[model samples]
Target: MEKTPSACAMQWNIELERDLRSKKPGKSIEAILDIGPRLEWWSRESNLHAAEYKIFGLIPGEDKLFANAILLRLADAFKSGDKHMKICIVKIFLSELKQRRQLRGQGRKDEGILSKDKVDSYRELLTRIKIVFDSGNIEERALALVLFGCWAHIAKDSADVRYLILSSLWSMHILEAKASLFAAGCISELADDFAHVFLEMLGGLLVSSETSRTIRLAGGRAFAKMWCPILLADIAHKTGVNLILESSEEEFSLVMLVSLSKIASKWTPLIPRQVELLSSFMTKDRGLSLQVIALKCLRFILTKGMYHFPANSNVTLKLFGVINQLDFPPALHFDALRVLCKILPPNLDTIPCTEILTIFSKFLQIVEFKLQSPVISERVFAIHVLACIFDKLLGILKDRSGIGSIVSSRMLTFTFDRISY
Candidate 1:
């Protein structure tokens, strides 16, 4: 006779219980691997709910067993298991940690807080995981870092636990490790006292000549997330104008530029200066890739600090110059159009109708030209830019019969012509 799905679940549950109860670390690891796949199965298989009741009940409440048996053996499993098995173990840790957090949130102190016996087991597990992080393969080390992050809440109250996590940030240099640590820092909301330390470390990695390109980029991203006014000012002063003018390393400069772009919203005082620097870079015969980045940084600045650039500002004209230049690539053209759209003042009343009309007229002419291009991508890009312009200025343009009628006629002719073809 064939077994029902329920029967299969029951058998696996029995085997899992036996494995969890076993003294050998390998058996406990096998049980953890088994539970990984069945987690979704147990949740979705309504018929197997009764069978799942015991295992679910066993796993969360048996913190001592988990800390001692399962977590202690994870280092070995991470070392020996294939990618799938290693992923399964990490999933199990995350699930259990989540449950512990939920229980603590609900005031179940007895279950959430470890007892004396379980405390020792938990400490041992941390030690073992740290060992894996210190000596394991790249994937293993990354996984270990994730586990440390999940446990960062515990570090809030325990000095030892806090030290272990902070120390791991220095020891792990891989990009993945850095990303994991930064994310964990965000979640843990590291105390202000330690924030500077973390920022300093990330800054060192970003500026260090010895750092690989990938690590440097990751470090830049990390620094952006942890940025504050004081730190930003410090970095800006230290790098000074040399960041744009004298930095011979293109990749490093690009990373710094991109990072600064993200924090534009927070640092309003520097917007005008950055606008001038990036505008100069774009107008020059710089690398196409660098120009694209500079355009994007300008876009971010305009989006965050639009009030700083009046319609007649030199910055606005510089942007127009970028758009009108025939030699620039379509990609730069598209991004410049985006920046222009962002430059439109939120309140139309602040700028005169003629000034706005002049801007729209220029935009409409560009769209009309690009819409007629033989290349499909250029035409598509033109359509997108047209949509963005209309989306931003549609209300203001509607009141101006001359430009509005021109826009309507151009769009209708383009649409019908394409359909007829």
Candidate 2:
């Protein structure tokens, strides 16, 4: 339970802000750091006020003393501070939270006089922050939630903070997207009460064309980068996959596909599902960005061998059409070709050996055209992809006797006509 701010604490809050602002250089504010954490009226108001300023007024430094002193009374200030003052307190606490994370990252122990009994103290401080967060106005609540998400990496009591985060994220305020992404990254311990609502909200944002593109993309990115990993942490695979599949917008789906490919590398069963779903977006009509991302994700999934891709003639032919089209960006062109290469040894009945050779032959003509262009990278990328096709093609021609004469004869004629270009 959190303590309500007493009248004396409110008075000290004023004095503290004032004294720190007025404190002159070389004045010993050490007395402020020495004041015990207890909020007692017996202590002179002027002294606590001076201490408060002394601790907060100084710029943060490597030394933990000032940070520790401020944290000691921070919860009290949070309970009593006015709106602006509360924001200031939130800033200081968040800064300390960042420093704590940095210390852990550096492999340094939490070292300071006040930090000797750190766990209990920091936990209590976070509890106070949570109390303030629950009771603050919109701006205050959003800011406090951001602070919690920022510390999501190290906070042990995150389960307590998760629902509040979900509420803020659900509001879709300008602040919600960022705070949600941060929380999604940090709050791996989120409860299903929070996760269920959050996934639903993200799904709606991602699927809705009415939602701002920025927010939609952020939702997709957050789900893949942060939410998927966390939900999958405890075997909640269906929840994450379902949300992604439920989205309707092309951009949102593309963003989610890219995110899923990055995180789902170890989750093999998901690869084909992602590939199959993303294949629809690899069409001539999809936006270049969506097409590129979808194809890239498909390529990534196949290259990683995350799943055994059984051949689908319809999907294979669609990819072939995307490859055959000239309107998509060159990178996407390469990605589409790469996807074809990855799903090689396709079931011949579905994606026939002859059809594969024909695609590669046309693919060569595309590359040969690029080689004469000024963009050296595209030329180089195209040549590299073309080379890979030939290498793969040669092996296929050698292994199978049925299409050897026709494919080899056509390959020779195509090579003679375009290889020098």
Candidate 3:
């Protein structure tokens, strides 16, 4: 009986793994050579798994001979194969290039540096790549643009390459998903002279719904790679917080907020002012998950972030309001309380102690009511919140003489009553 494609694929994986594991020299190269015929057969059947395998097989550089031979075949395919074949081959080369660069950057022994001749060969191959990049087909063009970013170092000094990529990025209609992702990926490779332009562009996309989620997500990931804190701070200064706050996509805006807090320790004066706007997110018509994300953003800003959140009593008041509105259980409410605590350090005497006590008393009432129909988990979370609030207030009351009164004693008694349960 003829072997099924499924069986053939399985046998092929087994043989490749065996060759990869074999102690015999040249056996891996033999296994790679065996792929040439299979490539033709797989291409005839349009088998994506086979195509994916072909690309992944060349990722490890354990055998330079096998890897180089596979790379050369892929280049040949790029030149001679049909469009689908070209795309698959280029993707393989790009993935291998990234793996090699990552390995080299970490000071690991890599597929030894490309020889001068090999460098020249790749540079020449790039001329052919440009033809596909300018292809009429959008997907092919998108993939080609990504390939350019992958091999960006080869053409780092080439003005023509920079213009081609930048113009594509600026174009409104270019590969909507992929081209943007690859373009963002190449921002670090683009000329430093255009660094501001790239930052502004990425910042805009970081909040824009016009970009695909994958591309926006990619933009956020690439933001860390392309710019440092100083540059990021400068970009945030230029972009303004309102743009991020008014973003049509809630998740994307939250990502931008997280990235902003992470990128710099320096408080741009505008950042504290923006916290009011950010606080409003807790009250937005959104889900608990999104509210959780906003709470995390606030926590990041107050705790890990360098900027000091303004000690406005109103911000605390608004947060407590959010806690009251939260439909989620007490456990999830912990995030909001955590953010409140970060802002409510004993030093924040600007916020009236009376107002603070009222907030805690209201929360105790809610906890006491819930305790009447106790869920063990919710009850535990309620206890945790009560402890944090009491501990915080105890420290403040000891420092401020007039702040502790008969009302404070009753608040303590009420808290202790709940805890005894």
Best by lDDT: 1
Give the poorly placed runs of model 1, Cα more than 4 Å off: 1-125, 133-143, 149-191, 208-214, 227-246, 264-281, 296-315, 321-332, 345-361, 374-421
- Model 2 ranges with Cα > 4 A deviation: 1-120, 153-159, 169-181, 189-219, 225-251, 259-263, 287-289, 299-320, 338-352, 419-421
Prediction-by-prediction clash tally: 0, 2, 0
What's model 3's lDDT at 396? 68
Candidate 3, residue 138: Cα displacement in angstroms equals 1.4
Encode model 1's per-residue lDDT on 148-228: one tens digit a residue. Answer: 655554334445545655655545467445635554454334344455556656555555667666665565555444435
Tens digit per residue, CA lDDT, model 3, 1-421: 4432323554565566576456687664565556545533432332224444455443322223332343444454455556665565555545555665576556654233232222445656567667776664676677667766666655555666666776666456536345645654554534465455566676666566576666665565555444344555556544645555555666666666665554432454545744665666666476566666667767766664444556676677667766676476665466666676566664345557777667667767756754654467666666666666667767667767666664477677886785688
Candidate models: Cα lDDT each: 0.58, 0.56, 0.57
Lowest summed lDDT window (length 10), candidate 3: 58-67
Q: For candidate 1, give the lDDT.
A: 0.58
Worst 10 residues of 1 by lDDT: 40-49
**Measured by TM-score, how close is model 3 to the native structure?**
0.61
lDDT of 2 at 215: 71
TM-score of 2: 0.61
